[model samples]
Target chain A: MESLLERYRNLVVLLAILVAQIVGLAVQVRRTSAGVNTLDSSDASGVRLIRLWANTVVSPPERLIHSGFGLFAGAWTNYIDLRHVRAQNRDLKQTVDRLRLEEAALLEDARQGQRLEALLGFQEKYIYTTVAAQVYGTSGSDRSHVFYIDKGARDGLKPDMAVITPDGIVGKVRDVFSHTAQVLAVNDTSSGAGVILESTRIRGILRGDVSGRLEVVGILADERIHPGEKVLTAGGDLIFPRGLPVGVVEKVVRDPDRDAFIDVMVRPAAHLERLDEVLVITSTEPRFSPQQQQDLSVSAAEEESVPAAVKDQMKASEIMAEKLPGLIDPNLAPDQQPLHDSSNPNPVVQPPQPLHPDRFSPGSAPDDVPEPDAGSPPDAQPRKPSALPSANGGSTLPGSNSTPEATPQRNL
Target chain B: MALLGADLRRDLEIHRYPLLVYTLVPLTALVLQAWLPRVVGRYDWFDLPLVITIYFALGRRSPIQGTLMGAAMGLFEDALSHNAIGINGIAKTVVGFLAASVGIRIDVENTTVRILLTLGLSLFSSALYLFVNRFLLDLATEWSWLTELLRAVGNALIAVVLFPLLDRLQSRD
Candidate 1:
């Protein structure tokens, strides 16, 4: 026991350690009470100060070890922050793109009505206007340019009617249902429209070519036409109206006198990929007979033949019905009909020049015309005929003569 | 002046009090050492400072001596760790006292026995620390049981290997 007492003298080291721990405990308690994590903050501060002092007073090895540890940890944190920043930047870019698209759509919608007013050259003369639509997506699988329009087929849309953005001609309507119409974009490769150059009055068949441009070939090479000339629709044959923009000459490759033809390439005015709402042409075709065609100088539907201009007049009653909706026959006046039945009255006898019902109406649209793949627009979802299938299916086709005598009296 | 000279001679002879290392060493490590640094390189458990402390401190003369030694190690740990300051201090002190009491009563002079005893004590202490933290205080510790066991084993081996040398140093001083 006496020997043990001698050994107890060595416990001074232990006593010092205990005192140090007790001091640490007290400091931590005070900090914790103040709602601070003293163990973390206080210890970190102490460690940093101690390390700096040790580097000055203690072995260099110890200082090196601490500094190396800190650098490694800091580097790891930087890597994590960099990863998070990259993901956030990608998200921000997508949001900016979406906002710009929305702005373009709103502007396009406002411009459509104004454009029609300008084209008519009379204030509000061509009255029944179209709603603006924007192309949402594309289907790479089916290669369809099905666009989503603000106005559906309900807004007086018919199959085969032309579609064009303000940039210029787009395509004609392939099919029309109650709430949507699938347009064949200008670059669909399966497209042909009549186009004539405004500068040279050079009429040609504007076919959408494989090079994704327009090829306007005139039958008569004798017609002196030049490149860098603007093309407009020569609407005498009533395909597209005269003075509608087709395209400008990109390159003119003139062939030395071959057949009586001048072949020229015209770049399309519309960018099909970035399609928005387009002008769907109202058909103004006159029922021309075979003898009438024989007498005409040009057989092409696009060439402007002189017309005996008749004084076109409208009655006050016709104007009133147009002002008050649902009074005119939709089958006769494609613009006046509502979505449900259009309920336009006596459209068969309404048009001053009535088309032979058999000649004009294509009867019913084939059900097998696969619902233009929705890979393009939400409106283009494949044919699901579960609801109102009968009412919406082929009930109102373009040029359908609705002789009001047989039809029900619907409220205007 | 005579008393002060005597005290200075005693301290100089033993080279005992390393106040900077004992008090501030753990504090510095705590701030600088990242909680979860990249595991690309190897982590040698023997190199851990806490294991070094245990190797030196457990060779203390009595249970009280071990307890005090443990408190120093614990305080350093608390300063660095983002946990309760006194928690490690109390836990380590108790482990020290238990180990010292058991060691003094046994044939601790046998190196093999000393190594085994140190190994067992390290494992038991680490388990006890974890249990007290998780169950009593609701503290979080990660990694699987197998990995934690391996870490304890490494620390124990280090302590066992270094204990005799540290013990001799203390006695020589």
Candidate 2:
């Protein structure tokens, strides 16, 4: 028996080691199958002590190296890279000027949308706060598409928080350690999110294929899905906020496995392969932006004063006037302007203060009121008031010809 | 039989390295494996740990030492990765044991033989890794023969550069 044991010692040792590993794998598999889905779990309950220890040992050096690189790069760029600064600054100034005009237009549209949303009592999830994190390392295996971020639980990071870049959504936090966390890239097989096509409004589940490409599943083959359509987060997963840019549809193909379903390939908006810095959305609480809040308050005050029947009869122009009192013609005397009248079905009740005073130039018509084009007819002169009471007792704007029924109402 | 055993023993050349070489080489390989992907962006072709494991296992030419070395390196690699601790451990342990067993029979001093051995073992380790992931743990893995072949070739090319550098670390005594 002793001679046999000695003769087969190498084999015995190999078997023992393999069996030990197999046992550990089995334990982990069991733990994983028993509701410890590591990919989506938002707590440390699914994490192994060994992983914590490994991260602790591995993360510090990576952080140090990343910081060192950042400092060196910063120094080089700040001190030495001045050749294009003046040109870049000029270009940036032009961009800022263009963006300011675009912002004014967008702000008006947003305020209008907010007022309508307030009327419908719709609640929205906003990205309230985010933590900036520098990505320093990856899982090192192509099979596991996860990366380590410098900020972790100590920085108030929790698992399943959405990570994003200015370009688009990246992924969500998978595991959180003391000072570092693992972020599962959106293109990882186990990662998923609720997504909606921006144009057609078709909804689907965004999943990562085996080859690490993003694919939208659960969409029917009959749907007309074209390439280049934007995809946004549906926010049904409760991890990412609604309407965040996800990606664009790259192609649509018939699923070889399922004939009824078509696979929508997506090219991720964020550069998943080359991530340097990411923003971890720490909170997805339903909070309004300051502009939206002011609009809501003004809406609430106006709604309180105006009866429901009167509000229902109010035209879009009247609603606009109520929201933006600055659009009232400065030339009109106080009595000439439409006053609060409960009996008048189309009475325009002005709010106590303009919701957005800066939106309009002082003592002038609102920017949105079109100026008379020199090539147009004499009857096309600029109207005195941005909004006025028509002879038919319905409020009308200077340029808008659409009837109340034709005015588009935003859907939820 | 006595003459045949003597000839086989004479063919087997056991190489030794300083303890630091043994310790730091694997440690550095693991650290670089984790760090380089961030620098280079999803560099899946080059696997430093597997190459180092094959290098040390072939040089040591002892099954027990090779198996233990493979286990330590594999476990550490697994620890650094998001994989379960034992999947790489099992694959690398088997590769280590096999490399050492083959080393005792062949003239591993030949560069061509060393490259071929590294290529074969890298493929074997990758296959075992896939098997353990797919069949054993029911994990989803993207398997491509072309990619695997290219990776094996890449590792072989890396070994061509690395084996010579590692040979310099051998203790002359």
Candidate 3:
């Protein structure tokens, strides 16, 4: 038996190695299968030790090389590339000027929208805090489309956090280590997110195909999807926030596997192949714009200050104004309009007071009277008041010191 | 205990390298494999670890050593990647054993033979990888014969340039 073992030792060793590996593979496959049901759970915990070792072995050199390249690139851009600076600056200045106007218009529109949203009591998820990470390496296999970022758990990164660029979303954090994290690109076959077509409002699952292309599935074949329509995150996956740009529809074709479904190919907005820097969303909060929040607070305060009966009266008046436009003369100023109470036969007319009674010295002008403007037309001048009969049958000017015994009413 | 016949063993010329070459070459290959693609974009056609595995396995001319070397390289490659640890291990171990077996009988020092061998082994490894991923693991893998062919050709071309540079690392003693 020993002699036979010696003779076939090499073959036996090969078989043993292969069998061991096959078993390991099977174990991993089983674990992965189990983990798939819990979509947000970390996968392959058994391999974490190996992954950690590998990362420890590989990360330093990669960081060093990346820094070296960055230094050179920084020098090139900051010092060596001065020839285009003046022209670039000029163009940037022009862009800033144009953007300033556009921003003003957009700010106003956003405020108006936010005010309306506050009125409707709508809440939305917004990106609250993000950590900037530099992409220094990848998984190094074409089959696995993942990137390693410089920031990780130490930098407040966590698994399943969304990674994005200014252009659009890139992917999500798959695994987080102390100093580095793995980002599964959206184009990875295992990666998926809930997405919606911007124009058509059609939602579907965005998945990466075998060839690392983004494809939207689960849309009906009859849906009128056109190329160049925008795609955005639906936020149902709980990984990416809703309404972040995903990509644009590149093409729509009938799915060969599913007769009822059509596959929509997407051109990713973020350049997944050539990513350098990414932002990992660490936390999100439901929020409104600052102006909207202020408006909401003011509205709440106003509602709190007014009594319910007064509110009802104001609402009734608004309804009445809407129904009878002729009730209040549109031409007359608000204070100049006659106040008529339907229950009372006689209405009291309040005279318009002086614009600046404080400006006049004592006895220089009547406190309740407005001085006539010299430049105004004769018709625009304040008319002198005729003496009215008092309760005692004594004639007295309306502004005179003698007080009326009862609330004075004007005969129409 | 000898797996090969004495006559066959007599014909084989074993090549040796400094210990640093053995350690650093594979390490460098793994590092560069992970790093270069990020700087140069996703040029997945070339694989440095596979090239290093094939090159060393061919030169060593010992089935046992070659198999062990391949397994180590493959495992490290898998470790560096997001793949299961043993997937590349199995494929590369087979490549290593085959390359060494073929090395003993043929003049693998010949440039044409080296290119052909590298090309053939690359395709074999890719096929094994696909089989494992699709059938055993039930993973979705994009398979294209044309792309595989191009990748093999690309590895062969890279081997042509790399093998000669690596030859200088051999210990004359």
Candidate 4:
């Protein structure tokens, strides 16, 4: 009887953990389902409003916490501050790197805009707007690589809204409430971006898997992609606008097998680990062309002549193209992606399809794994909750780099 | 109000579940010493709720009670913290059990022995908590030997001093 009771006691304890786990997993699933069902844009806006009200209400407590965090950082910095020049140099160095990146991005944007304008024979029009958010807190234990922001639905933020730090793309809005949100970083196993190799016009997909590593896929046989080259979004399909700096190619390994594709690793353009401020581009493409030496005066003169209404209209469309995925497919009931009639560009579009690698999608990876027209993410070996959940149970995870290999389903 | 006496009675009853005295005394002390003040602030760097569970839950004699109670506390804390629902609860329950069972187990009932045991348990549990919570999850964690030592010694002293009073209260009842 005593032994039975002891065994029962152990069972009860185990059951407690099991029950909690079930509840946890259930909540994760329910939230994900909710995310899938809702219109992410409006959801972000609502979240921002809630965040503002809550922020006002909780100012005292929030300030206390913030001050405490600041104090901790301050204490650490105090020691570093003694070496003022070093700190300044570090900040200066980072600033210098940032300015250089912006210079390059600006130059690239100008060139791309020129090409696009020439191709379409349309007047080059660009729009620039941004939303600034101060990162509040992050889920330290979140293997999902999610962070919290002070901005919420009311703050004009919505789920699916892209987030970036000063350096570059930080993440996308995952879930949001009145005054706060969870942003999923590009380093998570799920993020896939349309990237083009700067050196070789070869395009591929940039896959962010568990290891905080990025890879390029879909390079054609004739195109030779090398390491240490730059990778940027081709803005293919405009899921992300073209010209946002992605990362630099770190390694390029050629397989010995005749038909095997090359392996290209990329170091992200932004230093994701220690991130502070970021810019949320409010529109697709830049509003100002590299003011040509000849047109600078004429454009400056004409800039004041444009009516405010036209600017507003341009802002609406620009924001829609850059921020909201709604314009791409207006008819489909949101939450039901397949229900939406997204244009497939071409029935016979050549390479570089940067879509989410969901085998569950109606057309499980199309026949040739569309070679990207430009910057492509390499076909990762296999990954976690986003791409391949099965990999978690299979092969030995790479040591010191246990990046999940495409997990398609995460149980909360 | 759920009747302060009634809550007190419930809490008293709560303390009787096999090995709860050892858990409660230390938890109460640590909460008072380390986490109580942090509760007033929102989003403090240290996770007070996790601290409460780790410091209190595992030190109990009955691992079952420790884990279950820790889980309950975790759930309540999660709601208060406005976290992604059950994340805190789940993490707490796991931490509680591991701390109570495979965690640094000690059987020192004497005041001095209890204090020493409490300190050792606290140190080891905090380290374990850091490992699972920070290292594995990649969340921001500040793992300092001094902080761990301070929390451990502080909690142990409280347990050693408080448990006897609790024992006396139980005897009178």
Candidate 5:
């Protein structure tokens, strides 16, 4: 047995090594499948630490080399860029002047839009906080569609926060380390976001295929979806706020497996391949803007007095109600009139406040009437509920049918 | 003339590589593999580490040495990647053993043979990786035979150019 082992020792060692590695791989697969899943927020911690150590060792030299190249490129471009400086500056100045004028006009329109949005209870999502980070490297293999950013947990970055550029939404922070974070680009197969068709408002879930192409699912085949429609975030996922530009639809086809849903391909707005710099959103606040707040306050104040346009409509209704007979309550004290629409057969009476007897006494004259200022809320006692018409075409108040005309004269 | 038949076991010309070349070559390949996609843009088929593993394995002409070298190189490559550690290690170990076993019997010194050998080994490694990833670990992978062939062609093309330069670093037996 010992002689046979010595003869085939090389083969034996090779088999032993391969088997050991295979066993180790099996152990990892079991651990990964058991309960440690990246989607479940329990990262493959064992592998992550190994990766972190590897990155820490490898990144410094990479950054050094990158910076060296960047410096050289910057210098070369600066020299070449100086050739047309004077002419370019003059043209840029003229363009800036034109843009300033256009901006003034647009600002007014934006302010008006804000007022309207305030009235509709729309809350504008603003980037409350952000951390700018340089995209140092990518996840090398195409199978793992993620990139590493220089910013990390120390930079206040957390998983699921939206990472964006000026162009559009890029992706979200997937894993955070002490000095580096992994951004799973939206084109990664594992990543998904809630998105909507900008034109038709048809919402769907956007996901990436294994080929790194983007597609949206869950839009019905019959929906009026077309190519080139802009895609925006629906914000239902809460990671990306609503209405952030996601991409544009590239193609639409009927889903083969499911007839009810259509497969829509999207061309991402941000260039996913050539990403260099990105902003990691540390915090976002979806709230009313200052202008919106003021507009909302004005709307609340106006609610009490009612708009002039609304008041005119109310006066027309009141005058029409007065022509109907036996609607006014004659015997009811002047102070006891319903405060709201009594002219309507079914009046929605607001809860009435108690009235003193002296206010309704016959001796009280016009001089004694309390006048409300233009800015003040309408007095609660104003215009006692006009007499409501009863089911039998009579007033509900006692003696209202007997002396309806007398009641109007006294109210006037 | 060198491709003519020679005794497989007795006439094998085994060579050694300098310790510096052994250490620095793999480190350089690992670093370049990790960083090149950033500079030259992404090409998934351009695996620098696999080429280094094949070069070292065939040069040593010993199955045990080749297996250990392949395992170490693969583990470090895995460390640099987002993938789990043992996937590449197992694949490279198999490649190393096969390449060394084949190296003992064949004239691998010819440039044409080296290129073809590199291409075949790369495809074999890639297949093993996919099998282990898909069946063993249940990891989702998208495979295209056309892409795999193109990748093999790319790696072979790289081997054609790289092997001559690396031949200078081989230590004399």
Candidate 6:
């Protein structure tokens, strides 16, 4: 047995080493698989502990070296770049001015759109607040395309929060440590977003393949999708809000493997490779613009005044009915006879434009006819409605005892 | 050239290194591997840890010590990367053992042999890593034979320059 062992010693050692590694790898894979269903932040505690240990060991020296090199490099660049900075600043200022004008125009359009939306009962999701973070480094592997941020749980950052740049959607915060966080870039295989095509408004699921290429699925082959058309967040997943810029369609091909689905490749709007700084959306809620607020107030006031205006107008009608029995057209049916207009017996005193019950104001009803409690001016009463010649040259409201001239005028 | 060959053979003489060098060299290599890509950008393809592991493994020329060194270095790399812990460890251990076994049998003093060994080992490590990730862990890895070949070539070129530089650190005994 000793001789046999000695003869196969090298082979035995190699097999043992491989076996040990394979066993270790199996344990890790089992833990990883078990943890996959939970929140990514809570899932990889064991793996994260190892990561933290390594990062703790590596980062101190890394930070030292980075800062040391950055100091001299920054000083040199600052000095060198300052030469043309003034000219660049001037150009940038002009660009800002132009953008300001464009912003004003956009603001006006947005207000108009909001008003229409209010009328249609549309509710918008607003990016209420965000936390800014600097990207420190990447995962250092092509398979796990994640970037590390300087901000973490300490900075109100949580897992699955949307991270974006001014240009477009970057990704989402996956795992938050004490001082650092991992952002799963949109190009990672596990990362998915609900995306909508801008022009077509056809929504589909955006996902990354094994090759780190982004493709949108679930869009039917028959759907019209043009290259370079914009894509935006649909907010179906609830991680990202609606209407955040996602990417643009690079190509749309009918997927032969799947029936009724087209494979659409997308080019991300944000430069995923060159990300330096990102914003993690901490909270999101509905936003109400100033115009929307004012509209709401106006509508509320109108709602309150509607019943009062109708009551006041009814009181005036009752007073007229009590005072002027003859002026009321007894010949016509009750429904056909005008109720409030009979109070305005003076046809020469032009009746005010009809009040819309929906948008009633106090001043909208006729002011020429005074209330019974209030005294009217002497010349207020004029010719009655009976005085007006019909197009047939006859009195329209006929056989009434009160003639235009003989009609008893109200006490002015 | 004959003198260089003689020197290379003499340089292969096994001698104990100081505790500081044994610890610091590997640590520095790991640190640089993690850091250079951030500053220089696009240097990720240069696997410094693997190179360092190969250098030490070949220098030691003992299969047991070589395997152990590779395993330690590979674990350090795995901790740094977000990947599974033992994937690199397993691949590097196999490479290190084979490299040491090869070093014992062959004339490792030749520069051409050093380049070819590194090139062959780099490819083997990469393939083994992919296999472990794909089949064992069920993790999806993007693989291209062309890309791997190009990277192997790059690592070989770097090894051609680096092995000579690293030779200075070895014992004269």
lDDT of each: 0.54, 0.79, 0.80, 0.56, 0.76, 0.76
User: B55-171, model 5: which lDDT tens digit per residue?
Assistant: 878877788888888887787787776567778888888888888878877778788898889989989988998988887777667888777787788888888888888988877
- Model 5 DockQ (Cα-based): 0.24
- For each candidate, the DockQ is 0.13, 0.26, 0.25, 0.06, 0.24, 0.24
Candidate 6 docking band? acceptable
Candidate with more favorable, higher TM-score: 3 or 5: 3
| Docking level for model 1 | incorrect
Model 2: per-residue lDDT, tens digit, B1-173? Answer: 11224246535557889999988788777777778788888556888888888888888878888899898878877777676788889999999999888877777777898889888998999899998988777776778877778889988999999999999999976
Per-residue accuracy of model 1 over B1-173 as CA lDDT, tens digit each = 12224334333433233455445534443333323223433563432444544443434325665676566556555544456665666567656666655544444556676666666666666675676455544445674666556766776676566555454444343
lDDT of 6 at B77: 91
lDDT of 3 by residue, B41-102 (tens): 85678778888888887888877878888888888888777767888999888888888777
Clash-forming residue pairs, model 5: A337-A385, A338-A384, A338-A385, A339-A385
Provide C-alpha RMSD values for all models, in order: 29.6, 40.9, 37.1, 46.1, 36.1, 36.8
Fraction of true contacts kept, per model? 0.23, 0.60, 0.53, 0.13, 0.50, 0.55
Q: Pick the candidate with the highest DockQ.
A: 2
Off by over 4 Å in 3: A31-41, A71-412, B1-12
Candidate 2 regions with alpha-carbon error over 4 angstroms: A31-47, A60-412, B1-12
What is candidate 2's lDDT per residue for A238-304, written digit by digit as tens? 9988888999999999998988989999999988998877788897664678888999999999889
Docking class of 4: incorrect
Model 5 lDDT tens row, A173-249? 99999999999999888899999876556789988888999999888884467787889999899898787888999
Give the DockQ of candidate 6: 0.24
